[model samples]
Target: MTTAREVLDRCDALAACSDAPERLDRAHLTPALARAHGLVAGWMAEAGLRTWRDQAGNLCGRTEGREPGLPALLLGSHLDTVPDAGRYDGMLGVLLGIAVAQRLRDEVPTWPCALEVVGFTDEEGARFGTALMGSRALAGTWDDAWWDLRDASGTTVAQAARDFGLDPGLVGTAARRPQDLVAYLEAHIEQGPLLEAADRSLGVVTTIAGARRFLVEVVGEARHAGGTPYPRRRDALVGAAEAIVLVERTVRGSDAIATVGRIEVEPGAVNVIPGRAVFTVDLRAATDDARDAMRDTLLAGIAQVCAARGLGMRVTDLYEAPATPCADRLRDALRAGVVATGDAAPLDVWSRAGHDGMAVSAVTDVGMLFVRCHDGISHHPAEAVREVDVAAALDAFTAAVRTVGATAGSGATVRSGATVGSGA
Candidate 1:
C-alpha cells in the first residue's frame, strides 16, 4: 500500500505544478486551473478508474465493485481553493479519495459497492459570490437566478462556464439520482486549532453549525463635527457603535456568537457628522432556535439603540443556513476507524464556521474526517496541517470506507447513536 507520505507528496507536486497560489490577488483559472484539473484526471486514469466531468464542471472518477448493482459510496470535496488558500484545503479530500480507491484495488480486490470520487468546482464563492455551486448543482439546488451574477469584471457565471468549455444549459444534469449513491464521505483539514490544541489526530464532525448573516443600517442627520455639540447631534456612527456593542452583549448572554466583521460609514469627510452607517452581523449557533433567538436579540438591540440616539435603524437578513447533523451510521463507522488504528482519542467537539459539509449532508448520508490545522487559521496564506495528522486522517477515512462498503445492502439500518471510541 502507498504510505500517506507518498500520497501527500503527490498532492504537493500537483500544487506546485498548478496555477493555484497562496493568494488571490492576481489569480485567474483561465489556463492554469484547467491544467490542474487535467493533472487530477490523468492521475485518476493512471489509477485504473474511469473519469468524467459533470454538467456543473465537477470531475468524477469511479471504481467499480464486484457487485455493480449496489448504490456506490461517494467520496467528494471541491478542488477549487479560496483566494490565497492553502493547497490542502479541498485538494486533500479529492486526492485522498483517489488514494483510498488505489488501496482498495490492491488489497480488497472485491467489494459489495462501487466507490466514486468527485472533485467539485467553485466551492470558495470567491469569484462568483456563490459557495458550494458544484455540490448544489449535484443536489439540484442551483437555480436560474444565479446565472446572471457577474464577477468584478462584469462577466456572468454562464459566460465563465462557456469560456471554460462547459455547456451552461446542461448544468442541471449533475444532480445524482437517489439510487445512484448510498453514502458520502469527505476528508478535510480542520481549518482550526482545536484538534492540535487537544493533541489529537482526527475529528469526526457531529454537526455543522447553522448560520445567519444580516445587514444593519443606522440613519441620522449629517452635521459639522465642530458645530454639532454632543447633546445636539444625532450621530449615525455613534448609534452603530452602540448597536455593535449591544449585539455582542446579546450573543454573549445566549448560546450563540455574533461578529461585526464589516462596517461602513457614508459621507466620508472627516469634519462632517456621518449621515448613515452600515455594518454586517454574522451569527452562528449549534441549533436553529438559538440562531433565531440571536437574530431577534440583535434586531431588538439595534432598534433600542436607534431610538435612544434618535436615529432610524433597519436590519436585513442576507442569508441563513440551517444546522445539518452528520449521518449516524457514518459517525459510528468513523469512530470504529479511529479505534481500529489504536490511535483514537476521546472525541473532541466543534461546529463549522461556514457551510460545505452541511450542504452535502442535506441531500445524502454524509461523513467528514478532520485533520488538525496549525493555529486554527484558514483562508489565509499561513494555513497549514501537520503531516502526521494528515496520515492519521487517511487511516480513519479508509477504515470508514471498509465498514460502509462491507454493509452496503444487508437491509441493516445502522442506528444514528452508535459510538466508535475515545478521542486521542
Candidate 2:
C-alpha cells in the first residue's frame, strides 16, 4: 500500500515540474504540466491501474471489478493549480485518490464496482481563462467558445491542446455518459480555517457555494488635479473606494461572502484625476436563491451609489456557477467512513470555494471530503498537511469507497448505509 509519507514526498518531487524554476506554476496543457502528468501516470500504473490521458488532457487510471460491466466509482481531483500554488490544494486530492486505489487494488477484483481515478488537467483556469475545463469536458459540458480563450502569452486553448498532443476537435470524446458512473468522489484540502479551528481532520462538504462575479467600471471625467476644484471634479477613484466599502457593508452581517480582489484605475498618476475605475466583485452563498438575491441587492445598491455620486457605472457579468450539493448516499458513505475513524458526528461545511465537483455534477452525482490543512492556507507555498491526518484521511477515504462499492454492483443500487470491513 502507498503510505501518506510517500505521497507527500512525491508531491515535493512534482513541485519541481513548474514553468518557473523558483515557484510552483504548473498551468494546464503546458510542458511543465506534461512532466507532472508523466510522473503521476507512472504512480497510477504502479497502483495497478491501466492509465491513459484523455482527449481533454486529463490523466486517468482504471481497473475492472468482480466481472466486467460494473458501474465505476470515479475518484479524483484536479492536477492543475493556480500560479505559485501550494502543493496540496488540488494536488493532495489526486494523490490521495491514488493512495486509496493502491490500498484497494487487491480487494477490488472481488467487489462489484470498478474503480477509476482521474487527475484533471485544469481546474484553476490559470492558462486558458476557463475554470474546470477538464471536469466540464468529462461531464460533457464543454463550451466550444472556450477554444478561443487565450492566455497571457496569446496561446489559444486549441493551439495549446495541439501543442500538448491532444486533438482539440475531438475534445468531446473525453465526455462520459451519466450511466457510466456510479458517482464522482473527491478528497481535497479544506482550504479554509473551519476544520483547523474545530480541531478535526476531516469534514463532509454540504454544498459547493454558488457564485456570481462581475467587472464593475466607474467612469468620470479626467481633469488637472491642481485646476479641478473638489466640487467640480468627478473622481472615479473616490467612487470606487466608496463602492468597495459598500460591498463590505452590504454583506457584513450576512452569510454571503463578498470580495473585491482586483481593481484598476485609469490615468494612474498622482497629478491626474482618475478618469475611470474598474474592479471585480465576487459574491458567493450556500444556495442559489440566497446568492442571486444577495447579488441583486448589492448591484442595486451600487447603482444607487453611482447615481448619487454623479458617475457613470457599468457592470459586465464575468461568470456564474450554481451551487452543487453532495448526493445523500455519497454523503452517508463519507460520514460512515469518518464515524468509523472515531468521529461519530462529522462536521458539515459549506464550501466557500469553487471546485471541479461543481462541473462534474452535470454528468453524475458528486461528493467531496475535505481534509484539514495547516492554518487553512491554500493557493500558496506554505500549504501543509500532517502525515497523521493524511493517514486518517486515507483510511476514511478507502473505507468510504468500500462502503459505496458494496452497494453499487451491476444490479445493486447504492443504499444509504453499509458496513465496510469493521468500519460501520
Candidate 3:
C-alpha cells in the first residue's frame, strides 16, 4: 500500500522542479518539463511500468493486465501548472494514478485489464495560452493553426516542439483511437470548498462545466483626470467596472459562474484617465445552452455599459469547451468505491475548473474522483489536502478500479442516489 506521506513527498519533489525560483511554474516544452519527465519517468519505472514520452509530449507508463494484450484502462491527469500553482491540483492526480498502478502491479498481478497512467504535458496552457494541447492530440482534435501560436517570448509551438526534441508535424502519432482503450479515469483536487463543507474525503464528479472565455476590450477617449467634466468624461475603466459588476449580477440567479480574472488599464497612472481597459471573462455552466444564455446576457450588459459611456467594446474568444458527463457505469463504480471506503453516500459534485477529462471524453467514457482541497483553494501556493483524505482517496480509487474490472463486461448501469447538482 502507498502511504499518503510518500505521495505528498513526491508532490513536493515535483514542485521543486519548477522554472520559477519562488513558485511552481512548469510550462510545456520548457527545460522544466524535461526535468519533470526525468523524475516522473524514474518513478514510473520503479512502479514496474514501461515509460515513454508520446509524440504530443505526454509522459505515459503502462503495465499489462490479466491477459497479455487487453485494452488498457487509462488513469491520468495533466502535469503542467499555472504560474505560482498549488502543490496538489494536477500533480496529485498523476501521482495518485502512479501509486494506484503500483499497487495493482504488486497485489493484483492478474487484473482483468491493463493499467496505464499518463501525465499530460500542456493542460494548463500557461505558456502558450491555449489549453489542452496535449490531450487534444490524444483525442485526435489537433488543429494545424495551433502550430503558429506564439508565446510571450514569441516562440511558436512548432519551434518549441523542435527545441524540446519532438517533431511537431508528427503529433498525429499521439492520437488514440476510440477502440484502443476501455475508459479514462482521473483523480484530482476538488478546487472548491464543497467537499470540505460536506465533510467528505472524496466525491464522485457528475459533470464538468462547459466553459467559454473572452478577452474584452473597452476603448474610450482619453481625457485629463482633473480637467475633464464628469458629465463629458468617457471613462473606459468605469465602463469596465460596471460590466464586471453586471457579469456577477446576471449570473447570480442561474446555474452559471462568471469571473473577470484579468484586467489591464492603459496609461496606468494616477493622473492619467485610462483610454482603454482590457479584461478577461470566464463563464461556465452545467449545459452549453445555459452558458450561452449567460454569455448573451453578459455581452448585452457590457454593450449597454459601453454604449452609455461612449466606449467601443470588442471581444475575442480565447477558449471554449463543452460540458462532459461521467458514464453511468463508471459513476457507479466510483460510488461503490466510495461506499467501500465507509462513505454510505458520496457527494456528486460538478467541476467548475476545466480538466483534461473534458478533452479525453472525446475518445472514451471519462470519470473523475475529486478529493477535497483546503478551503477549496487551488492554483495558489496556499492550496492543501489532508493526509487522511488522500489515504481514503487511495483506498477508494483502488477499489473503484477493481469494481470497473469486475463490471467491465457486465454492462450494468447503477442509478445513483448521488446528489447531482447542475452548477459547479
Candidate 4:
C-alpha cells in the first residue's frame, strides 16, 4: 500500500531538482531536467520497470505483462514546472503512477498488458512558449517549426536538444502508432476549487477545454499628454481599455473564458499618450465552434472600439487547440475507482487548464482523474493537495487501472482515438 505521506515525501524530493534554489523552475532539456530525469528513472527501475529516455527526451519506464510484446498501457505526466512552481502539479502524477505500478507489480507481477510510465520533458511551455513538446512528439504531431523556437537566451530548441545529448532529427522516433498502446491514463490535480468546494477528494474529468490565443495590438499616434486636448487625443491605451472591457463582456455572455493576461503600452513618458498598446487574449470554451464564435464576436467588438477611437488594430493568432473529451470506458473505470473509495457519485468537471493529456489524446483515447487542490491555486507556490486526498487518489487510480485491464479482458472494444461522448 502507498501511503500519502510517502508520496508527498517523494514530491518534496523531486522538488529539489529545480533550477532555482529558493523556488521550483525546472525547464525543458536543462541540467535541472536531466537531474530530475535521473531521479525518476532510478525510482522507475526500483519499481521493477525498465527505464529509458525517448528521442524527444521523455523519460519512459516499462514493465512487461504475461506476453513480452503486449501493447502498453500508458500512464504518467510531465516533470517540468513553471517558474516558482509548487511541489505537485505535473510532478505528482508521475510519482503516483510509479507508486501504482509498484503496488500492482507486488500484487500481480505479470498482467494482460505492459504498464508504462512516461515523464514528459516539457508540458509547461515555460522555456520555449510551446506546451506538450514531449507528448506531441509521441502523438506524431511534432511541428518542424518548433525546432527553431528559442529560449530567453536565444538558444534554439534544436541546439538545446543537442546540448541535452538528443538528436533533433530523431524526434519522430518518439511517436507511437495508434495501435501500439492500450490507452492513456493521467492522474492530475484539479487545479481548481470545484472538488474542494464540493467537499470531495476525487473526480473524473469530463473534458479539457479548447483554447485559442491571440496577440492584439492597438496602434495610435503618440501625442503630448499636456499639449493634446482630450477631444483631440487618440490614446491607444484608452482604446485598449475599452476593447478589453468589450472582450470581457462578450466572453461573459457566452459559455467561455477570456483573459488579457499580459499587456504592454509604448511611450515610457508618463506625460505621453500611448502610441501602441499590445496585449494577449487567452480564450477558452468547451467546444471549438463555441470558442470560435466567441473569438469572432470579441474581435468584432475590439475592431469597433478601435474604429471609434481612431486607432489601427491588428490581431495575430498565436495558438489554437480543440477541446478533448474523456473516453466513456475510462470514465466508467474512474467512476468505479471513486466508488471503491466509498464515493458512490463522483463529480465530473471540465478542466480549464491544459495538460499533456491533450496532446496524447490526439493518438489515443485519454482519461484524466483529478484530485482536489487547495483553493484552486496552481502554477504558484501556494498550490497544495491534502494528504488524505492523495491517499484516496492513489487507491482510486490503481483501481481505475485494474478496471481498465478487466474491461480489456471482457472483450469490451476500446478503439484508439475513440471518445465515449461527443465533444462539446
Q: Model 4 over residues 1-424: C-alpha lDDT tens digits?
A: 5577888998999999989898999999999999999999998998888999988999999988777866677899999999999989999999999988888885434566778999997899899998899999999999999999999999999999999999999999999876667778999999989999999999999889999999999999899989989889889999999999888887787778999999999985798999999999999988888889889989988999999989999999999999998888888888999999999899998888899989988777889999999999999999899999999999999999877753443454345343221221
Off by over 4 Å in 3: 106-112, 223-228, 265-276, 307-314, 412-424
In model 4, state the lDDT of residue 279: 93
* Residue range 5-38, candidate 1, lDDT tens digits: 8768866765664444544321223455566678
Question: Where does candidate 4 have its weakest 10-residue lDDT segment?
Answer: 415-424
Each candidate's number of clashing pairs is 11, 0, 1, 0
lDDT of each: 0.76, 0.88, 0.87, 0.88
lDDT of 4: 0.88
Selected candidate, larger lDDT, 1 vs 2: 2
Q: Each model's TM-score?
A: 0.91, 0.94, 0.90, 0.94
Per-residue lDDT of 242 in model 4? 93
**By the lDDT metric, which is better: model 3 or model 4?**
4
- Model 4 CA lDDT for position 300: 89
**In model 2, what is the error at residue 386, expressed in angstroms?**
1.0
Q: Summing lDDT over every window of 10 consecutive residues in candidate 3, give the lowest-scoring window.
A: 415-424
Cα RMSD (Å) per model? 4.1, 3.7, 4.6, 2.7
